[model samples]
Target: MRSATESQKDSAVLAELIRTLESWKETVVIAPDTPDADALASMFSLAKAFGDGDGRSAKVSLPENSLSQRLAFLHEWANLPVATAEDFARADGFVVVDTAKKSRCNLREDVPEDWDRGRTILNIDHHASNTRFGTVNWVVGEASSSAELVYRLLQAWGWPIDPLYASLLYAGIHTDTSGFSLPNTSKSAVAAAAELVERGADVVELGERLCRSQRLSEFKLLRTIYANTQLAADGRIAYSTADYQEIADAGCSAADVDDQVSVPRSLHGTRLAMLFTEGVRGKTRINFRGDSGVPALPLAKAFGGGGHDAAAGAIIAGPVPEVVAQVLPEAESYLNRLAQKP
Candidate 1:
């Protein structure tokens, strides 16, 4: 639960986002570098909201074409095209969704420097670690996902909400909350979901697409993790790593390896799970998943990354072995502290 003061601050920030959106034209919406369902849905919704106006269009920017096929439904629902260099240059402003830090946008490498120079930047996210890096930051960590916040924003602005948009919002809330199984799944999340359903979000189809649908390569990656997971902290922590060769051997793409965090996390006794994957050259992406008593943020931040308590991630510049060697002890240490908390 947020304190009264923090709640008030969130309200003010949200109000500011509404005011800014009113004047925004030719805006660009950027999700995280490696966006999950939540980030993708949030980006698509914002683009839809802004792009529907007369003489207005919004560009959706991503690090690359890294989204899974499961999210292909979103591409069909809305023209969520990836922004190009020309689109970025033509954009007058930016709206960043589902990401906390300005640095995490990877915008520095993907776009021109002046993109951040004097343009209006709007930051909308639900992570507590957000730096309020935009001219107007509407971050509310109490929300289930950034999609829920976007839903609220549209309602506040009296923007149109169709079934296509509702499903996009529902997809974000569903995946980020792990189908409302995680502790971050709040009463508001439930209420918002109900509203989206009423607005025509197909709950059954969305659930199947988000959860049950998996590619062959994803299953192969899961099988590999099952065969190689290592335990520490007396079984409280379980971790696994997949190097480039192993990942390719499993016939998985970088996006396919992203969901492997769930494999170690599903262990019966594991309280914290980590998956270190070597995707990009010279960089290891570490994904964290924690149980009720184990929080992932501290460990993620210790490595210069940030996310929610139960699920977080970081990208370290090193080989897979060296990155895993450095991160495992930290996970064990954090679990030990949790064990001693009583």
Candidate 2:
């Protein structure tokens, strides 16, 4: 864990980021990767801050078709523009929030090379695996969510946050921290939530909407996956999968199954859990979750993807059976290593 001084240094970077945005005279584009609730909320908040300051014209863009229906209620979702890397090239400045790496941003392939080299690029995120790819990086791994970081950014800039912005930001923080139940929850997280609530964030209503609200189809899919879960020989490893046909039968989208992947991983006796799902174009996405002291990023990197120590993911080019056959052995070996450790 970083000391309080280290954390304050990370927080101070947000002030520098605000100074950079304040000096910009040309068009600025705010983009977030994959359009998840956290990404959209953070981007929208930052865009509002930029627009409110210095008469600067700011636009919000995302990779096409990335916004999920579940998060359509965000205020900016309706009017937010969709732009590719080409549009980004012409912008005076770029703000990349929620995602820190180009691979995760899903930027268009046709964009010009070196498009962002001369432009000021500010990277803001809460992911521990962030690659620090921006000219000005405000990566705060200790924050509960990117929304929390965005909230601080708004405060530093003295931007007014109304109820809508508060709700959106609260949703991002709520969802990412699993309602403050995840291991990363912190004192600053609670303080941020309190401030947002005072500014008209409906904690109870938002909690119900995010946690209690779920489609019936998602429930059916979760049932199938839970029923098929398997525990390893030592009972410290668990694995589950949902093939294409099963997904179709449940009538649920990939996002619905995304949240369930971590359930098996959280079992009391399990040191690690894996969930495999069939992805677009015959690729299978494997999500890895592990307890403390277990490294999941290296394991995920072996399969061409990367994430944090406790949670990671990978996409493999193969059928579910082949992926499971390859992945299970690695997970087992990892468990054995843990057992062999002093």
Candidate 3:
């Protein structure tokens, strides 16, 4: 982890990035990882900052089906150019936001093996496990969300916060912090939220749109997961699984089911919750959530996945039943250790 002083130094890097961006004569392409609201919002916001200037046009690129219905507003939501990697290649420079690792960008297959290295690549993210793989990396793991960093950067650059940019950034911070219920949330995050609201973010509307709004398919998927939820001894650990067939029957996409897996974790007595979903590529996606300080990331990493302490995931090759059978015991053991904490 970077010290407070080191983090301050990292914040300084954002100014350097602005200077570099100002000096650039070519078009800038802002790309974000797939299937994430925070990433999408950050990409669009940053693109707006760069494109609003003279001799500079910015485009936002993302993989297909990366944005969910809730985030689909961002598509028709803005006038910014949204395109794929092919369209991005036409730009002179690249600005990658919200994603620290190249693998997470879902661009690995699309990006050319030998792309131009001299083209300036600015990487900004808030993930603790960031790879820092960019010509210019501005990673602040402590920033509540990448959107928060974008808001700060915009402020530093003296960019005005329009309603569209403000709303998108608010959604990003809201989702990433779980509505400010997460552990790492800070005063800056709240202040950013307040400023966004003042800039016409429409908090009530966004809340209703994101949280209260749910498709029928999503409800059906949640119903299935609720039916299968099982609690371990003393209800300390909860486990649930949804097979591919069940998911298909619910008429829900992977993204819809993605969040339902965490339902088991909401059990009042549960210290840990595990959800296993069968993926199409002969893999089972496991999501872990816990209230205790068990640090699920290390365990997720053991299975070739990683995330924060309270939330983490892994993908294992096998049938859903087999995967569940393999992981449940491990999850139980983890809860046991957490319970034994002095």
Candidate 4:
């Protein structure tokens, strides 16, 4: 929890969000195109909490292709309607969650440009790298997940928190903190999680689905990652690359590789881990995981990406090999500098 002084500061920003919701007739809640559990949870919670009263409802704008089976059980996940560009363009205002900059939202370039003019955009997130692109930006870098921030907002506003909302929020906190194992896990995050459990969030089921459950595809991808892993910068940096063809040959898809990047970082000698995977439309997606001594945000920002200090990602136009060749030296150089630090 924040001190009394910090709480007051947070209240001021949240108050603006509450006021903005009350004054707007129609609002659009937007999450990043490739949103995680935290992003989806925040979007759903804000939409449900703010739009539930008499004649007040918010539409959610998300990419049609963004849904994942991992969260399909939640009512909020299954029922929340997806929005088109038209909905985004015509909405009176936007409540953007779990994303910092407008570009990171991954909406069409024209959509954000149009939405930015004379419109109210609430940029809410937990990334230290947030650019505060919203008219009312409420960013808490120390918060574990955006869902944790949403939980506080719900409590402050006296909004309804049923089992569905509680479960969604729990999933956000649970996954983002790697089941409370990551360094970002905070007391506030743990407290929020406890409240969600009290409200009947199914923590057991969430664990089974998010942590225990894994597909054969994921195992296949893991094999590829292990086989291809390489070490550099005096073994402080570990990196690997997987192309679409290699993943397909293993009978898996790109999604299976998403969580495998962190595997290398767990090695005793490694302080930073990287995984590059070929994405559709000639883009290569790079995922980074770092220890306390090695921050990933600078690497992400260097490639026009943004995320937290320990975990971040970027998408580069690629031939996967070329992208690897271009980034590997930079990664080594950064690690070398860290090695020389006092």
Clashing residue pairs in all predictions, respectively, total 0, 0, 0, 0
Using TM-score, give the best candidate's number: 1
lDDT of 2 by residue, 143-256 (tens): 777899899888887878887778888888877776787666678888888899999987787777667776777777878888889888588888888988787788765544
RMSD of 2: 2.8
Ranking by lDDT: 1, 4, 3, 2
Ranking by TM-score: 1, 4, 3, 2
The 0-to-1 C-alpha lDDT of every candidate, in the order given, reads: 0.83, 0.74, 0.75, 0.80
Give residue 318's error in model 4 in angstroms.
1.7
lDDT minimum window of 10 residues, candidate 1 = 106-115
For model 3, state the Cα shift of residue 100 in Å. Answer: 4.0
Listed per candidate, the RMSD to the true structure in angstroms reads: 1.9, 2.8, 2.7, 2.3
Error of 1 at 182 (Å): 0.4
The pairs that clash in candidate 4 are: none
Give model 3's TM-score versus the native structure: 0.89
Per-residue C-alpha lDDT of model 4 across residues 229-279, encoded as one tens digit per residue: 888877888888788788777776543455678767767888889989874
How many angstroms is residue 233 displaced in model 1 relative to the true structure, after the best TM-score fit? 1.8
lDDT of 1: 0.83
Encode model 3's per-residue lDDT on 1-342: one tens digit a residue. 457898688667977888888876555444444356677778888887888889787766655665566667766676677555555566677777877566565453576644435777788888666778878888877788889988888988899998888998998899888888877567889889999999999788889877888777677778889999998767877888888888778886555545565588777877778898873546788888767576777678768776667677877999898888888777777667766889
The best candidate in terms of lDDT? 1
lDDT score of residue 8 within candidate 2: 88
